[model samples]
Target chain A: MNTTATLSRIFAGIQPELDQVDALFQERATSGLAILNSASMHALASPGKRLRTALTLLAGKLNHYDFGKLLQLSVAFEMVHLATLIHDDIIDEAATRRGNPTVNALWGDKIAILLGDYYLAKTSGLIAEIENPRIDHLFADTVATVCEGTIMEMMTSGRADLTVETYFEKIKNKTACLIAACSKGGAILSDATDEQVEFLHSYGLNLGIAFQIIDDILDYTEDQSTIGKPAGNDLRQGMVTLPLIFALQEASQNGHQQQVQALLNSDEHNEKDILEVVDWVTHGYGVDLSLQEAHNYANKAREALYHFPASSDRDVLDELIDFVISRRR
Target chain B: MNTTATLSRIFAGIQPELDQVDALFQERATSGLAILNSASMHALASPGKRLRTALTLLAGKLNHYDFGKLLQLSVAFEMVHLATLIHDDIIDEAATRRGNPTVNALWGDKIAILLGDYYLAKTSGLIAEIENPRIDHLFADTVATVCEGTIMEMMTSGRADLTVETYFEKIKNKTACLIAACSKGGAILSDATDEQVEFLHSYGLNLGIAFQIIDDILDYTEDQSTIGKPAGNDLRQGMVTLPLIFALQEASQNGHQQQVQALLNSDEHNEKDILEVVDWVTHGYGVDLSLQEAHNYANKAREALYHFPASSDRDVLDELIDFVISRRR
Candidate 1:
């Protein structure tokens, strides 16, 4: 969690600014509404790596971004992230996140849903403070796009005919669009040229796709502790991620698709078979293939930043391409 | 369902405009996201009487409201209503709303939550189009307030010592604030005087409180076919509404507190006793007393409209105060 070990060294200029963003994010998330304040306080206490917030800050460094508006928009982006995660836990019926009691675990799905909604409101409220109609519309539209992505994923869940293209579409909606919104928003607030904004948006989108690919890959490569939940829970929930999708494609090519199909069809009580699938995915070229895809997106993200003048901020943004792919969690 | 019997004659002026609002609401609810579109289209098909929408339209009649902005805001209000209902079904574990399949019932809680979130995004997106910062802030704050109210209600779900103050607070949040937002938004969009805006706000708040009180009353008094759920479902779900609160107070005074307490304490086996409590409440002036409180709120709501001169729109608005109190469902 000591991003200072990595990002701090590269972001010597905006480190203090990043810290202020963190402080304000923590403060703003604590609402005057008692339940939201307490629940969000609990959730924000075990914060994510703030990769999204840092993305906004780094993108802002591309031009003369208003610090205040940037901080507010950054908070808005993180709250959107929090709101989705809170709702996701309810859908996943997850009891914990990163070993901390999920909102649903602490308070039932009822409170969890409401608290998620509270975060949604806070997200809107923060964006409204910025009073930028274009940004507000972007955030709202991104929210719908995110929902669309997940709903499509659910619609295709447990199906035998999951396509590679459909999987990319799902991940783009579920993960990448919000990342693009964050960077695009930051760039919009900055005195950046249209080219710079377009570049950052593309950078964020590519990086987001790459980040989620690695995350899906980690579901099999990493242990429970490193990944924060049981390994292969996605498969357990009948969700097919990139690694599993790639692995299944390989299985079909090798004519072992029947075994993989049997594993997919079996609901539970197929621990030995589940392990077999995991082994096929890990020991085979599944991890390698997925990592290759991630590397490709990360390279594209790097290329998107090719036109930007080299600065400490742009340098750190470029380094995130590697950090996103290499990080354990 | 035939609003014609009541509002048609009075709303001849705004008939076409209201139709436009409905058409746009239907059009906007559908998304490129098929699941969201289908689910929302289904929910919108079984729409409530659009009491909240009517309130905005009727309030707009007070002055020269921007028909475009008012229509958009009204649709936004309704979407907010729809979103809350979608999530509330998850909380209530309700299979149907108004005798139609709830999103949760058809697609399970995960899809239901996601669809509800999509509606929320649509809500914010619609408001962002209006480009009014104060109105935007009001809607966002209203959402948080609504969540706070519902969370508090869930927190106090099954207590022997539920306070009337707390009960009012819950209804005000769960039901009233959005109504207030609708009317306030209407007034804001209109060329209404500031005093007129204040009056409409008060009218909305009081009317909303009355509307919910009657709704709770209907839960006990109406049959399953009428209310869309079983009679006394509120108490069955460990929820204490206005009628039950009054019934418990009466039982205490009449020395039948143990009977009421026993029924509340019992799980599901005491259907007979629950019926007995309902009988006692219904046959024993519970409905009368609850209606009396509703009448009080209705009178206050009417008082807010006293300053408005005679007009058909005002006439309809005045009649709604009584309609909310007198109507069965």
Candidate 2:
């Protein structure tokens, strides 16, 4: 099945709740100021796949499934995801995201920065409404981890010697931690047992790892029309992701290491150089190896479901792992 | 007395606790990444006056005087203050703060932005340790208000027809709200009565208004050597603070309104035009009228303290009002 159909199938159970989440998010994003309101509405218009929202809602389904609390949690998580994307666009100097102009591109960095902070503050207020200290602490720690991960990526940019361990660490912090928080937080909101929360956390963490690994792989294999960014965009930005790391490891033994290193080390890389490296990573075993690793985590995510009894909710979560692995974008 | 001696007298009771707050801040700022660690340390090195921290500590003195909780609140407030300053420097395109290079100046805006987010995240974690839902909501709402105020300021920049009421609203949101949070939070931590909290909040709100007005006044009156920046810096940046607003009002009666409006509406302000406006505001009734407004607020702050019984803490808090109004810088 195609990505859209698969997501539709997976999200069918919680579609109403998801809509409510969107509604709440829109309400919160609206400000009295014209500029702020317009910029926020623009950001809200080009929504992502809402994977985190789905995760939160689906995780809540395993137990009590309190829609009120679950809706708030989903909206807060989505706001955080959007806020990070706004700031990330500023850092990347990105003109567009998901085929739309970024907040930083439409407005300016100053306004974009403040808008991101506003979303975060809104998230805090929403979490406080939940009246759960544990959730508050978890969300706080996750944001800090996300900041650290992004900093690590910025600091390690252009370094060809980045280890696979550091790559996992960085992606885990940048992406997986928040995804894990979504599931864990949802489970906590439903008053799930510690064991149940642990299992859901594990499932989300592994799924998130697979999700990001696929994202990195698409940077090599997919075109701009499909991926919403040019192929080899990551390489051009000096981000050494999983495929590039694997390709570099293989290139060191195959005598292509020096050429790649020179390109990475240079202040300005030509488009041709980037395409050449993209060809090597895509045509070689790098893409295949990375996909294999993504499947490994996907399987681990599936395994985590065994702890819960058979239910339609578990089935949707189970299918989500496959959707995460198979999606093109 | 000199500013130093006055502050020393006020802080004598809480000096040890202030030192502990500083120590804890340093430890939290130390990161594993070299670039992040160094950038954070550079920001930490040039500490601000810690007005928020002092407010938190002094307010806590009214009731329980719980050092542990007050310390956490104090540090968190200080971090929030510093984080806003870092982002503010980016918005201002400022190169130096407190006669030291800004994070943006030293490490670029991207790093500065991340560092600011990092501090805010740390603040969330600290507030979580306190485990108070009300405080959490307060901090979050205050942060959102601060962002809104900043966005309002940016949107209204260079508008010569800005109203006095709008100026008051902007300053209250951008400055007074957070300062008010510090006192309110400290009161909450120390188990003060709701009435006491309200009084402290009033004290903070009024003092904050007076503080910002004096700051605006100093921008026109003090030279670079005294104020750590050039005179008329706000006017040069098209800020339209209280003094300038008052001057614009006065200028309309004297037939100089059109000339000042041209300077404000221009895309780029030359030094001479800025100095001319600064001279008019300082030499005319603008400064005196603005000072009277500040004193009105300062007196309100003092009146708020009448509800509290006599204590050294009350004395210190009262003395702070004089220190705020009289300081040259």
Candidate 3:
């Protein structure tokens, strides 16, 4: 099966919830102003795989989380995700996303930025409708953490001193925090015990870390057409991700440290040089080491499921851990 | 007393609460990233009159709202306001605010935009701490409305077809809604009856409407250096305000239709012609009519307090209405 079909298989149990989220997006991503309405509809027209929403739904399987409330959280989480992507496009100066022109590309940075703010406002408003204080605080704090993480990443870009700990911390804030919130939110909505809630949080945390590491790896391994961005785009933008971090450590003894350091120090890099760097990182034990890290986190994520009784939901969630590490893009 | 002293006097009863809000700002505007932390601190270093926070404090007097809770709401509201202003400075291409360089000026549009989002996330997180769903909903809904209003304003900016009604609607969404939320939030935090909450809403609504119109009027009547921007800057930015709307109609009736039309259609406008348009608008019943409108709303704001029993809070609130109309800045 193709990636989309395989992912759909993984999320099959939440198909109905996903459909409701689509309807919710159609109904809610609107404004009286023409420009805002158009910008929102355009952004909504194409979306990333609804993995975060599915996380919320899947986390609800055992607790029998109220479908309506879960759906609201799902939609809100997705919107916040989309808003961040839109903002990220501006920050990345990305020309496209998922093979479509980015909002920033189509509407310019100003409107793109405002529309992102609008979506965030809508997300917070949606979250406010949920009355549980824990869920309320979780999403809000997660939003703050996510922005802080991005800012921190921006601050750290181009620096040679990026530690493994700093990389993990940044990813946790930027990527893993929202995913963890999604999991915790589902449990908080249900009748789950505190222990159950903690399990899901840890599950999401590890899964998100693995997921981002894979994305970073894909920057080296995947083709530009498939990834919808230039290969090594992260490196070109002065971002040092997991794969590169590992490669740099290896390069210290492997005699490629000078090559990697040259790329990092200079503001220029040709496509050929980028490809060669990718080869050095990917072939010279970089991908293997990064994959090793990804699997470690993925394994830890699966281990969190040990808290719950065996069931089909657990089986698929367990399967999702592998799916995260294996996905190409 | 000067405007600042008079306003301080009006807020005298809530001085302690306001001081707590200041402390809260200092405590909360920090971030892990030095850039974000410094940016937030710089934005907070000079704040406009804390009128909205005072409204929250004043509204709480009747129900004896918890000081701690009110402080959270106050800080959140002020941050949201500051976030909007930061975003607005980018939109307006403003160089300075309150005689200090704007965040956009200091750090460029990208940082300013993200910092605005940062402040907003901070606001949402702060509000989430307040367990009252009504207050939560109020702030969230107000944020969306404020953004919508701004988009509407941007869309309507250069258009000659801007109606008085549209202007009212835009200002209500952009300005009045937040102010109303400030008032209603205070009441919500307190144990006020539904009727009292509604009155506070109305009071803020009218006061906010008057506040914006006076702001618009000041654009034309205030000195270029004293106002910290060029006189008639709003018209230059293609912003159609109350005074301009009145002036336009007067210009049309006085057979200056061609002159006004030329000004609207052509981007080129010498300072001489801009000053002349100001003369037509301000001298020909613009300021008077605008002031009249301001007083009308200010009076209605006072009328909302008719239901409240006489108290020191009520007295200060009544005086604040006058302050809205008569303040030079």
Candidate 4:
């Protein structure tokens, strides 16, 4: 399958931006660097797509805010995201992350928890050091929102009858809020107008949904080794994802409701049983519909970027729509 | 034995201040109140000397600054402290606190952790609302430091030879820093002069040290029924307190170091054996001397407040010095 050309283009464009972000993290993260080196290094060196940081950089550049601090803002958002994952692993009792022993698995829950707090506190301190109280306020509020979102997610876990609306609420808080904060924060740092910030926020919000949906999709389809996690980990944990949401509805009407429910409740499902469910969704038009929904979100994100003046940055952000919807890994 | 009349006066002074602090907690702790209410209420209802809040208010009033939002700070710090205890119970595998089932024992460690995070986030949000970024900065740093301190305490838990210097550093961060922050933050909020703020910080620091030493003393002298925790808990956990530090040094010089070390390292020590050591210390001159050292610290704490204007608030502050050291339950 052909990868999105825009992915490479955006990657090339943000190389300088990534270097600046690394430098800023190095400068501010000195006090506890030696202590936190293992956890922090593992978190930073993970080979994520860097979609969130790219959004911040592109959003800032689109608003004519070309500066070094955008990279810092990118790193700040990424660090916040990393901190959440560290805590999430503890909550999830996850053993392996990105193909390595989880922090809690290696260092125990206490250190993992403290390391997460350290990163969060360090992020706030770095923001405060920028001498911009506005940024500090927004960053603190965003982190608080992230915590609230996590609480909500925990509150909803193990509920089989959770609605799509509630799921939207969870994902909005869990993922979109920070993505929106990233774009909005970047725009604000660039002194973008309120309308521009709002637009970028909407863009990031929709993009985040698409990104998370793709993550859910990849859980079923990607190589577990490459993904650094087991396949169907969410379903094993009883997490209802987009495909399950759609398939359950379809199966209910098709007289396979009991079968689908049995599969969900059963821990003994063999590979063949799982493959049947995956095949049913992949061949029955649900996969196309789900991907199309992600594309629609990408389109909305592109529309949001139109509010800004046209620039190569804006064009790159527009291409992100295609990049997000089409990426295979 | 008659307790100090000065402590009774300080308790009376804190009654009104506590009402104010309780109201602030009630006003701001909107969400998770139902889940947290029992723990928070238990903490609120379970009586401590309320010395920290008294120090906060007294420091403000002594500097002739209005106690603007200082009550909120008081509630936040105390709640944060309580939250740590809840999580600490889980880490320590404790079942009871203040003669009641701990949050972890009652609701389980999972809930305890989330509830702890909830309160911590609430405290952060509350501190952010204090209209001064400097105080917020200090509050955030103090929380991180406290976590670091506890983590260090846990890391060095089983070691019998933990240094006096390291123990001082840990207690300073875990217990004293917050107390010092409360005093300094109150003074800062009240527009106290630099010298006055410094004086309050020193007072709080010295008081915190004395407070902790007294706590250590009570662990040996007080009964389990009165203390609401097992007597000699710290020693049972192999923690090196001031008395143990003193006894160990004395034992070392007397060539009985191995005996003391063997007692601490013993996998099996009945309550009788435990009390034998306790009785030896109490009947020995070492315990009295250690307590005398604690009293010395308390006197120095009162001395730190001596330079302030001699108002009733200052008198209440002086009374608090005796009350903290006098705690038996």
Candidate 5:
């Protein structure tokens, strides 16, 4: 089955709740300022997978699913994700996201930055209404970690000496922690046992790691038409991801290390150099090794589901692992 | 007395608590990331007036002053202010602030943006520790207003038709809202009565309006050596503040309106054109008129204090109103 078909099947049980999340998000994101309202509406038009929202709702389903609280949690987490994506586009200086013009592309960077902050503030307001200190602290620490990860990424840009360990560290903070927070927050909202929250958090964390690893892989393996971004875009930005790190390790033994290092360390990346590095990673063991690592995490995520009983929600979450690993975009 | 001498006297009662706020800020801002740590440390080095911190501390002193919660509130609010400044400098493309190089100037916009996010995240963490939903909602709303005001400013930039009412709305959101949040947050931390909280909020709001009006006036009246930024800096950026607005109104009747309008609405401002507009606003009734408006807000601020009984803290708060209006920089 295709990705959308699979996601529809997985989320069918919570479709009504998901629709409400979208409605609430749109309602909350609307502002009195015409420019902000229009810019934000444009941004909302090109929606991502809403994976975090799904995780929150699904995790809440495993216990007491108060639709009201879960809706707030889902919307807030998704808004945080959206806010980060907007800011990330500004930092990446990318004109397109999901094959559509980015907020920064349509408006200037100043508006984009403020829009991101606006979303964050909106997220804070929603979280405050929830009035759970544990959830509040979880979301706060997750955001802080995400910021730290972004800083680390910026500081490490163009440095070919990045280790696989550090790469994992960066992605964990950048992507995984927030995903974990979503699952954990939903569990907290549902008044789940601490053990159940921990289980869901672990499930989300491992799943998130797998999600990002596949994302890095797709950056090299898929074309713009397939992935909604140019192939090897990360390499063009001098970002050394897991595949690149693995490729460099393999190239060291194959005598291509110096050339790759020189290309990456240069002030600007030419298309030729970016393509060459992409070829090296794609045609070598890098993608294969990274895929294996992703599978390992995917397996961990699958195992985490066993901690919960064999409910329909757990079944969907279990299928989500396969979807995350196999989705093209 | 000098501005510093007067401020010292006003803040003397809370010197030790102020010291602790500084220490805690420095401690909290220190990060394991070397780049972020050094940049944040540099930002902390050239501190602002810490007027928000003083307002928070003094407001808390009016009732129960729990040192721990007040410290957290003060530090969190100040960090939010610092975060906004960092992002604002990026928006303004400013190289210097308070006679010191900005984070964007020292590192780059990317790092500066991330650093601002880091501070905001740090602020959320501190506020979570306080665990008060009311304070959290107040801060979140304040930040949202601040972002709205900033976006309003950006949208209105280079438009010569900005009105005085819109100008007041802009400054109220951009500056006064956060200041109001600080005082209200302090009152909340102190467990003050609802009436006292409203009074403090009103006082901070009026005081903040006065503060920003003076700031606008200073931009025209003070040179680089005095205000730590070039005179007419706002005009150079096409920011039509109160002084420029008042001057334009005056020039409309005096037959110099077209020239000033042409100068302001132009694509780029030449130094000569900037100086010409500055001369008109500074030499005309603009400065005097703007100062009178600021004093009006100052009086409102002072009147807000009459609700509280006479005490040293209230006295200090009253003196703060005078200090705000009379400060040269």
Candidate 6:
């Protein structure tokens, strides 16, 4: 089977799991403490693509794991992701997310902080009910890794001189660790063999890296409205992702280093500067190279799953890789 | 054994466990994560009396339980408590806690929120390592309860008309639940009877309420240096605690309702207004009444331990009740 139908089937399997997220929230969250319900529900409304949850469910289905366990892990993984978002908004002082006011924006930092705590607490409660220490430890460790990744991001912000090695470490922590854990967690629950778990782990890590690189690419290529945040928002905040890093490198070679430095040193950078950087990165032929790198990672992600039995699930996995590389935003 | 000697032994048992807290930080926390590490350590240094941890150890010892289980529960309880403080500081916009600058104050709300998340993630990790599912579930549920309490506190802030019943619910979530859980968790890990666990739960709940009431009282009576925060800090933020509830009751009888209304209504609430409210509350015998309630709770807390065997551990538990009523800050 070709990749398109495969992805459609993967999306189909994810639908019911998304539905289960609400029920899990209600069951694990009824503390009878006031305002908690409202804050929690409000946070759940944040318009994320539910990427990590989808990854978990799709990976589990591809491995032919139990739907019940997959649903539980999907909810747990989503809660962890949501918890991170709640904290991130506070850090960024961001008022709007997904084109809506953030939790911190609506309620203030105090409530936002408490709500993040609430999400993690509820996540722990839900995961604990699973009654498997192995799963519990994996989930907990992933949370630690995510924290370490976030700390790296916080420290590295504003450093134009950040190395490519440091950049990969940050993305691996912030983006890939949880994604990898989602599949590893699914495989662990299904009692998959070590080789099967490792395969998915590799697939998840590579795909996650490719996914973030695509996100960085989109920062230059997409409209702000389409992205729900400003284009080059990361650059404005001093976060130099791959495309910007590559753009700076090319600009230096063309003896336009002063122009690039002037943009970074400006009192107020505007869209013109952003567009200039984008043109340099794209028109200079760096986009081809960056896209090639992304394709290589996506291809590596697919190759990691070659050990799996040839089934419809594996076909769906291949489609996900294609989707990862081709998606616009 | 008298209260002083009993309290001494409990403190002695907690000393080693307190040392363990340092190791927990040093191992799980990365040194290179400077902001995260500094904020965490700053919060940890001169930690809050280790009351919850002491209670866990004392409860276990009184029941003739092993020390190892109590130590784990103590660490878990303390971690949970510290995590809540990090989040609470964000909610309160608090500048200081335990006489030190708050995480939010020192780092900013962003780092505070992330650090709080990290502590909670670590707590879940530690708890998941222990084999008992009952204890695991209890930790998770307690977190949810604490979040509920924090949310209620946030919702009620700047709400001068908040009732005493509402205050009770808030304290139950914010303070009592985890304190209650610490004792109950210790008992669960040991061979304590079901009745024994109930006794400890009741004792902890009452003691937690009493402890908070005394804290509220001190908010009016204590010197600024001793309290660390300024007196009437809660009232400045428009919080109506127990003393205010009682004073409002008495103000109604003296036909000085207009004066009371002016105090509550003034947009220019300054040090004078704060001092005058404190005077009015103390003048109307409200402070004494609040203290009386605290004493009643102390008595009830002691009664909860009557089911336990006669031992110094039980005596320490008893003295802890007295300490709740006697603490100056």
TM-score of each: 0.95, 0.97, 0.96, 0.89, 0.97, 0.92
Estimate how well candidate 6 is docked, as a DockQ score.
0.71
Residue A37's lDDT within candidate 4 is 70
Off by over 4 Å in 1: A1-13, A31-35, A252-254, B1-12, B251-258
Supply candidate 3's per-residue lDDT for B254: 40
Q: What stretches of model 4 exceed 4 Å from their correct place?
A: A1-9, A30-35, A64-72, A253-286, B1-11, B32-50, B253-273
Rate residue A57 of model 3 by lDDT: 81
C-alpha lDDT (0 to 100) for residue A307 of candidate 4:
76
Candidate 4 docking: what grade? acceptable
Q: Give per-residue CA lDDT, model 5, range A212-314, as digits (tens).
A: 9999999999997676767888877888899988887877544566676687778777888788878889999999999999999999988878998898888
Please give the TM-score of chain B in predicted model 3: 0.96
Q: After superposition, how far is residue B127 of candidate 6 from its true place, in Å?
A: 0.7
Full-model lDDT for every candidate: 0.83, 0.88, 0.85, 0.72, 0.89, 0.76
For residues A198-287, write the lDDT of model 6, one tens digit per residue: 888999999999988887887777767676776667767667788766666665544555565566667588778867776777666556
Distance from true location, Cα of A327 in model 3, Å = 0.7
Candidate 2 on A1-329: residue-level lDDT in tens?
A: 55666687778878887788889989988878888789888988864547899999989999887999989999999988888888999999999987899999889899999999888888888888988888889889999999999998898888777889999999999999999999999999998999999999999999999999999999999998786788999988888899988887876554676676678888877989899889999998889999999999999988887799999889889888878888887
Worst 10 residues of 5 chain B by lDDT: B252-261
Better of 1 and 4 by TM-score: 1
Number of the predicted model whose lDDT against the real structure is largest: 5
iRMS value of model 5? 0.6
Candidate number with greatest DockQ: 5
- Compute the lDDT of residue A101 as modeled in candidate 4: 82
lDDT tens readout by residue for model 3, B1-329? 55667777778777877888998987887876889888988888774649988988888876666888888999999999998999889988888886899999998887887888888988988898888899888987898999898888887887765778999999999999999998889998998989999999999999999999999999998876667777888878888899878766765454565565567677777778888888778888878888889999998998997679998888888888888888877
DockQ of each: 0.79, 0.84, 0.70, 0.38, 0.88, 0.71
Select the stronger candidate by DockQ from 2 and 5: 5
Candidate 6 achieves a global lDDT of 0.76
Instruction: Compose the digit string of candidate 2's lDDT tens values, residues B164-219.
Output: 99999999999999989988898998899999999999999999999999999999
